[model samples]
Target: MSDDDLAATLATEAGRLLLDVRREFADASVDDRKAAGDQRSHDFLMAALAAERPDDAVLSEEGADDPVRLSSRRVWIVDPLDGTREFSEPGRDDWAVHVALWQDGELVAGAVALPAQGVTLATPTVATPPAAPQHPRIVVSRTRPPDIAM
Candidate 1:
């Protein structure tokens, strides 16, 4: 499979794992739930990458940063759980799983999966940017609004 395909696939799988973790730990404390989801998804993605792309290096939020990635030909940079707070909340869908490929100093491929919303946006399959609105728009999370926005 192409690098883009691999990125998309990894991201989708990671998102699914996050969803499963959330469900399995539904009654746990928010901190416990977040921790579980983060570690589980990270482990799944890292293991899959190691199996599928044994030669490539990986940089994951939940994993130790290996200096080896700097000299590697290809690196997979992943954020297993981008918005842990949102993911642990009862009814928030803003969290995402990110998988990106940096090859030869460039971001060759990437994907962001919104599992709760059942959406996966991948490079080469990414949607076209919407037309710019007449007014400028700044998007922010409802739960953690930036202090400067006030």
Candidate 2:
């Protein structure tokens, strides 16, 4: 499948995941959100990867802590879904969808989709690479805003 095809596929999967997690991730205790969110992310990522890059190993935030990713030719480090706070809450901007791909410890391509804003931003073509972003719009978590920036 093409990059966009993969992205679209992941997007669809993420939508279902968000719905499935709505009650499960929200009803859980506050302390469990982190773990639960991580697990949800891990599961979604694994399923997506299995369908797309089954040959490529995965090194995700919630699972697959493979240091080999630091050396693998191609590895996917996915967050599945970001902004657990917004995800658990009703209306907030912190929520987003993330799927990061790395090659030999360097980012090759990725996508960040904010379903709330109806923004599914793609990389390179969408904007400059994030590492040396010319106009940096710092990401600040809703639950914990940065002390320096708003």
Candidate 3:
């Protein structure tokens, strides 16, 4: 399939895996659950990309930073689980899975899946950004505050 299709599929599948992890570790400690979810989704996404696009480079939040990606023509940047804290919390739906394709210089494709919300936003399915809200709001991470906030 094309890069766009692959990105969306990977993000969606990874989100599903994370949801399963949450169910399987319902009684586990938050730290344990978070670790499991991160590793599981990271491994799934990495293996899928290797099998599907063996020639391209990958940069993952849970994987080693390979210098090879800097020289490659195409690179896949993924965050298997963008919000570990949110994922570990019961009933929280703000966490997401991110899969993006950086080709040449610009981003060619990308996807973000919010599993609990059952929403997957992909490049193929996205329309122009909605107009700015009359009352804009900033959402901050509960676990890691930005350096600027320090």
Candidate 4:
């Protein structure tokens, strides 16, 4: 598969795995749920990347930072579970999975999957943002809003 297609596929699959982990660990403590989600999703993405693109380097949030990627021509940067806190919280849909490919000097492909919302936005097919409402609004983190947003 092409780099763009690979990124989208991996991200979407990882999101599905995270959803399964959340359901399986529904009764676990918050910390436990977060840990499970992070590890499982990371493992899935790492293995998939390794198998599909054996020569490419990978930088993942849950894995140790390998210096080898610095010299590599292509690197896959992934956050297997982007919002661990929101993921563990019941009824929250803000969590997501992120996958990106950086090659040479630029980001060539990327994808973001919102599993709870059942949405996967990917590259190559540029996403057109919905028309802004007359009354605009900014959504910021509830606990730590940026100064600009505040």
Q: Model 4: residues >4 Å from true position, as ranges?
A: 125-150
RMSD of each: 7.6, 8.3, 8.8, 7.6
**Which runs in model 1 stand beyond 4 Å of their true positions?**
125-150
lDDT of 1 at 150: 65
Q: Which residue pairs in model 4 clash with each other?
A: none
Tens-digit lDDT track of model 3 for 23-138: 99999999999999999999999999999999999999999999999999999999999999999999999999999998899788999999999999998643577899998766
CA shift of 138, model 3, Å: 21
Estimate, for each residue in 1-150, the C-alpha lDDT of model 1 and write its tens digit.
988888888889889888888889899999999999999999999899999999999999889999999899899999999999999998899999999988898788899999999999988753568999998768577888777566
List the candidate 2 regions with Cα displacement exceeding 4 Å. Answer: 23-35, 104-106, 124-150
Clashes of each: 0, 0, 0, 0
